[model samples]
Target: MEEPIRILYVINALEVGGTEGQLAELISGIEKERFSPYVCCLRTIKDKSSYSLDCPIIALGVSRLMSLQTLIGMLSLVRYLNHNRIAIVQTFFIEGTILGVVAAKLAKSVSAIVVSKRDLGFMLTKRVIWQLKLIYHFADRFLANSKNVKDYLIKKEGVNRGRIDVIYNGIDIEALEKKMQEVSGADIRSREGIPEHVSIVGICANLNRKVKRVDLFLMAAAIVCKYLKDVFFVIIGEGCLKKSLLDLSEHLKIDLKTRFVGSQVNPIPFIRMFSVGVISSDSEGFSNSIMEYMGCGVPVVATDVGGNRELVEDGVTGLLVPCGDAEKMAEAIQVFLDQPAFRKKAGEEGKKVLLERFAKNKMIRDHEFYYASLTKEKRMAFKKKRGKFSA
Candidate 1:
């Protein structure tokens, strides 16, 4: 029997965010009999216990980008890849993509290099784009989480259409269902001092980045408050911009009805409390928050942006509005609030769409097939080269 292929996944950190959570879920759910998974972090992991993985995780202890430690870490990564005969090196985020691709190219035994693109490059600068373009030549394949991202790579970055594969982020429905069963929405509302009868419009996103456009959520919430007195707005997830967002909420006079429940390890309960789920991001690769909202049977009101349209069925499952248009967003939210039956039906349809299209098993199977095919092609190319030499 052939030995299982060894694939090393590299990332910036194991933080409690969409990218990290997706990585954890993929590694944990991947078929161990066919692929042996390992993880590498460019920096030290702060909370190792948060992820449940049996495979080894190596931290290179990189303190800064321009330091000698980063150089040493890169060399160490190459050595590890060569010594372990890594079949594939898969990288996430910018730092991981640049460093991992370079190291994988240097490693003699590495067969393939994959770069995961999860966002729309809203934060990338000209210098960073040039750097990424230089490194793109060494990578064997690119994994985009959405067609919107794939199109961006081809049209914006000059990548060939054949080189990119669109793999939508998957949700572990079983685990999500289990979490929903375990967590009580009533308990969470009580703890947060939210009244039982009030309608809740909520958003789950980090406030650190301006690209999330959380200000739009607050503005829309304030608009909703104008017509409805029995509604509350909730923001889940915390970052440096918390103070500024709070000030904005206060200025809008919606602070009295808003709850900023900081970062949550398990936000399912909070999601359960939402009468409507909202995503006000200026861009998205694919939103895990939208999936969570659908999984919890809560209808979504999202900006019509990257990958969002793919997940939301406009008038059927959820409503889509223009990015940065708070009034339009508020209008959509109001539509859901006014018609409970419509909201409930939309939520149900969203969940059905999620189950049919974005289940965990489907994602795992797709990845397994992709990895196996790449490695097989690599082996065939090597054999053909050897045959030519012999002839």
Candidate 2:
């Protein structure tokens, strides 16, 4: 049997964030016949013992973000990549992209390095922007989860368009469906005190008011509840804004119609129960939640910002409203509430989009093919150079 291409996935941490969760899914879904995967984390603040990973997840144990120990951690990463004979080093998010690219460049045995840009610098600091501007020059290729992120890198950061690949985020639809079956949707709705006939619109996001705009969701929900008596809103996930979001709901006098589920480890069941999946973010990269919602056969209503437009076609799979416009959002939700047949058709179409365009297997195949192609190009170039030297 031929040896599989060895690939190493590097990230800042293995916590419960978008990038970390996506990394886990990618490693699990990659074609085992063609690729052997390994994971390395700059830090492991969360419980690493809990996540079920196929490959070994090694932690470098760096305590600080930018310190002498961090430099040592990068050196250690270089040594590990060389020792493992890793054909490709793929780094995710900001810190990993910075540290991992530098380590790959410095490593003797490794040359191919890919960095994933998952966001549009929405939360970037000046120092981080400066570091990325310097470090990204050393990377071989960049992968953006959405065209929005890809364009942002080109127009804002001045990255070469040719060097960046736009690969939409994929979801494990089968796995999601299985998880949904494991938990009864009726049980969940009952626990939340949502009646079977009532329409449930939900937003599954971190309760970050500034970026995710949970407050905007509440404002929209208040508008929605006033006219649509049978509608309820659920905000899934936990963040610092939970208290303030609840307070805002009370202030708007829609507290009776709003329920904060607080961080759910398994949000798929809740998503499956949604009459409409909503994204009220001021900014986003390609949203995994939107994909999950569509996979569960739920229509989406997302803000027309970042990659939301890429995932949702207006009036097709779901609706799109202007960012921070609660009135517009409420108007969209009301359309779904008033027309059940139309909502069901949109949900079906959304599921079809997820299956055809953003399946987990498609993502793994694209990644495997891209990685193999990069390594082959590098090897062929090296061979040509050797032939020239011999002549």
Candidate 3:
């Protein structure tokens, strides 16, 4: 029998977010013959149902912060690694990253623990800094979602630059395009009560202060309404700040055009109906929504932050503007809306970038290769050290 590759993946929770979605894509895409995968969730599932995946998923129910329950959950994860003999341990987000790496060491099943950094400055903090440093000391490697994130880790936390590798979050282009093409956005708009003739501006954000600036999205929409007629704004995803955003939009006097089209079974339906997808985020690592919009053949007018520039080539693919500059954001979106030819050109160009750079298959293959390399290196070193000790 051939030796199967066993991978233990730890994530905070497999909720509806970019990092979680990326994990789903990778696990589904991996060649199961060469690799066997298992997952450990740091917290309980909100839905109270087992998640369906190609690999088995374990939930530790680590609900509290710095508690005995959390420690016990970490130990349970450690025991699983020991029992399964997990070779390479990979983690996502901050809290999981800290616990997973340390537990992997305790289990003695982890040769190389890889941490995927999602955001730079905001994601890291002084509270977790010591834990991160401890993980850094014991872990074999650190993998960043992008070069920008690697720069952040090195500059902010003083992580060893040589140990860090940059791997972009992989996007599934064919699936995204097919999903978009099969959608009936016309009916979706009708059901959402948005008229067909109105200019629709879409935002894929949960109203929040730290990440997606729902406030900025509303403000930009207010300015866009001044010049454009029959404009309607669509905000997707649900968050704590949803009600506050609606109130502010009403205060701006564009409440008529504002529609709080909350979370959907399929956001692609709403995403395709719009003339353009609006991103007014103050921070991002790599934007899945921005790429998803482009994949749907819709141009984006996003704030110039994180990997937004890597996806949106200002004026070519779609316009990029300074963060919080509502006037410039409105100007760019208006320009795309005014010129039909420009809209066509920008959308097509953006799609080209997604196909070439963000293909999901490429992302999967890179991880497969990385896993092989790390495992192979560990085995070789193990044999060498054993031989020396015996002699």
Candidate 4:
């Protein structure tokens, strides 16, 4: 009977990274009756991995930072927010949050601004950090993908602790189960020229040496190869460090056993192929791959960093090795490879954890509730100001 509350979801781009993928999933999951969602990408759609949502998408075609074109794009965003009378503006990533919050303030569109901290901000440049420090106070609320991220924002970036809310990433367990049933790991292995007898250890993350420590994963893989025969490794993502990582694999003499399956649109089949799932990141905000591994009944071996300890109970769900120790990582991976019963036990326990904590429906409900509550608070504040003016 009444008009739905309009919300704009803004991000740096509609690319296939974890943050972008989560944005797509969250927007797609929102109930249409309660909210009219719109998407605004700071850059043009460079890849085909974007979501085809029912709502309109406005791509500003921003390619460079701090350029004339970026300024034009920000102005365009401000105008759009004012014209559409968007009730809420939620942003992901550093670029989008900085720009989105600035635009929201400039437009004075009566919108509740929410920003998400999806990573540890280890990869953020100095310029972006400066901007964040300046504009973070303009945001009404902050959403962090993990408690680790929230603490980092508060302790490192000097953001108010009370303003940040920790929300773990969620997985669509039903959809994931359907995909796993539809695509067998053997089918994928056969197509990729991998032998069925080999034990596959795979990681699905953007290849970055500094952040993801993918080189460390490769090092561990090489170590595992010496003690265990008939084993293979797979890295399922693309990034700037691909060339160097490939070289490192060759240098380590594990090139023959490793496969770099560059950027997959649907990496679930690849993830399903793993005997062990690994997160070697130097830092992480809650790991989507860890959830995916557990969902597929695969045990994980992750470095004890970020929210990894939150998701994995060492020796229960999987093993946790110290960050940057290849020998320790190899030892943990070998434990799963050698003991089938232990792997199965750990995997089943991991699945139970996923079902109990990281379900998609619960995430969607939490987001919807947060949005509604913020908008209500904003409205009440506005009403109070109006009452004072009238009196």
Candidate whose lDDT is highest: 1
lDDT, model 3, position 295 = 84
Pairs clashing within candidate 2: none
Please provide TM-scores, in order, for all candidate models, with all chains considered together: 0.98, 0.96, 0.94, 0.94
Which is the better candidate, 1 or 4, if ranked by TM-score? 1
In the range 1-391, model 2's lDDT, one tens digit per residue, is 8788888888877778787777788888888888899988888547965467899778887767679989888888889989988878888877778788888888887758888898888888887788888988898899999999999999977789999998777888878888897789788878888888888899999875479998888999888887878888999989888888889999999898888998878888888889989999989988988998899889889999999899998999999999989999999988888899999999999999989999988887888788888989898999999999999
User: Candidate 1 overall Cα lDDT vs. reference?
Assistant: 0.92
Better of 1 and 3 by lDDT: 1
lDDT of 3 by residue, 281-307 (tens): 888778888988888888999999887
lDDT of 3 at 345: 90
Worst 10 residues of 4 by lDDT: 45-54
Error of 1 at 241 (Å): 1.1
Looking at model 2, report the run of 10 residues with the lowest lDDT sum: 43-52
Report the Cα lDDT for residue 39, model 2. 88
Report the C-alpha lDDT of model 1 over 1-391, residue by residue, as the tens digit: 7899999999988877888888888888888988999999999988888787779899999866678998899999999998888989999999998889999999998999999998889989989899999999999999999999999999877788898998888999889988886768788889888899999999999889888999999999999899999999999989999999999999999888999999987888889778999999999989999999999889999999999999999999999999999999999999999999999999999999999999888888899999999999999999999999999
Would you list the C-alpha lDDT of every candidate in the order shown? Answer: 0.92, 0.87, 0.83, 0.86
Backbone clashes, candidate 2: 0
Error of 4 at 175 (Å): 1.6
Candidate number that wins on lDDT, 1 or 2: 1
Model 2, C-alpha of 137: deviation from truth (Å): 1.3
